[model samples]
Target: MRRLLNDLKIMLLANFWLIPVIALLVGALFYFVAPPPPMHAKMATGAATGGYHAFAERLRDELAKEGFTLELVESRGSLDNLGKLLAGDVGLALVQSGQELTLSERQRGDLFGLGVMYREPVWLFVRTPVTFQRLSDLADLRLAIGSDGSGTQAVIGALLAANRIEEGAYPENWQRIGGSRAANALIAGELDAAFFLGPAENALIQRLAAEPELRLESLNRTRAYLARLPYLSAMEVGEGMLNMPMDTPAKDIVTLGPVATLVANEDFHSSLTPLILEAARKVLENGSLLDPPDSYPAAPPRSLQTLDEAEYYYNKGLPILQRYLPFRIASLADRYIILAIPLLVLLFPLFKAIGPLYQWRIRARIYRWYKHLREIDLQLYKGEWPDDLDAEIERLEQLESEMGRIEVPLSYSNELYQLHVHLRYMIERLRTAQKRRQA
Candidate 1:
């Protein structure tokens, strides 16, 4: 045992360069491997008082439970959010589904999306006694089509342009206001009509429905607008959908808008995609007036490419480990898996190499003693028995005793036995010489 340990120590010291070389290689590998998920995610949501903001807050609160925090940046609306995302200022944003954004190849390359969360409709609410016979007819009247950079204004422009109606250099009666303020203006007779791209649950939409003086216009040209744009979809506010007692929205009101897409920057970490999708399912899967049951999180990403992680989650569900482990732990395992595969392939041979090297080290210790025994036999064969013949015999006997005292592991016991046999032969020759000298 002592001989083997001493030899093993020497072998390792001889190849000490392996230690630092392997460490450097591993360090460089880590630079390319996927990093651990960051603790925080930044998102661009619409107006602070808008539905997008409320949805973002709900999502942020849910993420906190999994040790992930969400940073919400308030903006004018989807257009502003898109600008922030494309600029790399934020990793996530809520973008309205319609409007074929004029993206350069570079911009398009960095755009990806999670699925739609819910539906948002473009409502054209007009004051009482100023009914809409057709969309083109109202272009000459007072209209409030949301403020600049808002999803409402963007969608309204697309709808108008599709209808062959272009904004004049100065449309005399056109006004720009927030959706809620526009609704208020229409109610006070300050505007003839207001355009809003909001979900059914929006406070202004609900408030306007309750007002007797305000009425939702039936954009009877929904099919025409839908034909002109692929992203736009026709929706209807059912009669008495808001309040059965008040019989609000007295009749079916046809409208058009695009779905709300959950978009992420191209470089956003893939691990975070599932978390946000799951959060969306938890927050919106329940049936709302606009959000249908079991409709969120799994739908195709609207107006953008579907994120690969979200596609995996929708198809395979949480990975087997993630289903059992907490999110943080599961995420760690997932990240390591990419590295572990190649690492295992590499380290398996390194570990295998160690066993053979260890065996060689132990065997070398046993062979070294044999070399000494051969040299001693060669010297004694000269038949020289000096006056110190007894002393010479004693020395040979001590050598045999020393050989027996040295320990070897059981697996190498045969080598130890061979060593002892050689020692005995040397001792017999030494004693024979002593006897000859006595004669």
Candidate 2:
């Protein structure tokens, strides 16, 4: 035991920097790579008058109740939101579905899906008497592709380019406007047609439907768009869907577009999954302004965030675990039970073996010295004589004196004492041999 301690002390002194270096590496890895607890997440929302901004404020309030702060950063629209998310300027954002995703290789690492939030219907208001039946029919007409770098612009531009409607092929009236302004422009004859994608209750859509001169274009080419782009779903806006103080649409209007999705970085903590799921449940499970009752987990869905454990639970009708155990116990068990198996498998054996292994190592060192003394004694018994018998006696004496000062456990005390006895006998034999040689 004492020899082991002495060796440990020497090793510590010789390699003192090893422990500090390991500690520093561990600290650095934990600080930079490990996911943080539920924290203040920066979110890039849409323009103040837009639906994205409203959704962001509501989400922020919900997350605040769970000890998280959501900082809302206003952006132009979905395109700008995606840009900020890709740039690492924000942790979360709202992105429109069905838009072709074009990411640089570096930016692809930063992107991941959370889940679909709500659908944004592409409300196409065009002038009456045009008799537009298909998307290609409006190729030569003046159409608003929405403001630059907006979600609407990206979707509309891609759809148009797909049908070979190049920049100059259209009437060349592109208005940079959004919300009510864009709607009013179409109504006032400034724009022949305009596109709006927002909540159903948006005032601009209501006002446009009331105008007798304008008509909502129904793209009966739903099957064609769906065949080409699976993400685009046809939504039915029934008569009287919107009310301008009880003034409603005269007939049913069908539109096609993608849903907006709530997205986060891929490395978003698994622990925060429950909290995010809870927040999503509060906002999404029940019907909102757009979705009817229980119409969520939307069909033919699109999302920037990938499904995880909490999302799976939300989808499966959040069953209560407390029914199987006491409430208090269940809560504690759920939080810590995942760690128990690994701890038992790895640490339990290590702890059980450490004490006995340490004792065995110490005893082995003591037994080795005793073996050397026993060999010398056996040589004398065999009548083997050497000229240096006196020197061998001195060496045995020194070894015995050193062994006497060693500290050993009570269990090994007998073995240590036996070594001392053997050393003494060896010394006596060596002395007798010397005396006989002298005679």
Q: lDDT of all predictions, in order shown?
A: 0.77, 0.68
lDDT per residue (tens digit) for residues 1-439 in model 2: 8767766664455345446755764555445543445566788888887777776777788888756788999998887887887678887778788542565545654666666667778878788766677667775667777887788777676667667777556554566566767776778887777787777755566677777778776667677777776676788877767654444444777778878777776545555544554565576667754587555433223333355554555566432553365333444465544444554565577557656666666687588897777677667668777558867878888888888777665557788888778778777878887888999
C-alpha positional error of residue 370 in candidate 1 after TM-score superposition, expressed in Å: 0.2
Off by over 4 Å in 1: 1-32, 298-303, 350-355, 377-398, 433-439
| TM-score, predicted candidate 2 vs. hidden true structure | 0.64
Q: Top TM-score: which candidate number?
A: 1
Q: Clashing residue pairs in candidate 1, if any? A: none
Instruction: Indicate which candidate wins on lDDT.
Output: 1
Question: TM-score per candidate, in order?
Answer: 0.86, 0.64
Give lDDT for model 1.
0.77
RMSD of each: 4.2, 7.6
Residue pairs in candidate 2 whose N, alpha carbon or C atoms collide under 3 angstroms: 112-304, 113-304, 113-305, 113-306, 114-305
Positional deviation of 20 in candidate 2, in angstroms?
18
What would the per-residue lDDT of candidate 1 be over residues 1-439, giving only the tens digit for each residue? 7767865666676456568867875876687777778878899998877888888988899888888899999898888888898899999998888532656757756888787878888777777778677767776778997898888888877777876677563277888786678877788888888888777777777887788877777788677778887787888789888666667677978778787888888658878877778778788868588557888765654446777788888888766677788778888887777677887788788768876776676677678867766666667766444457577568767876777765556667798888778777777776787777678
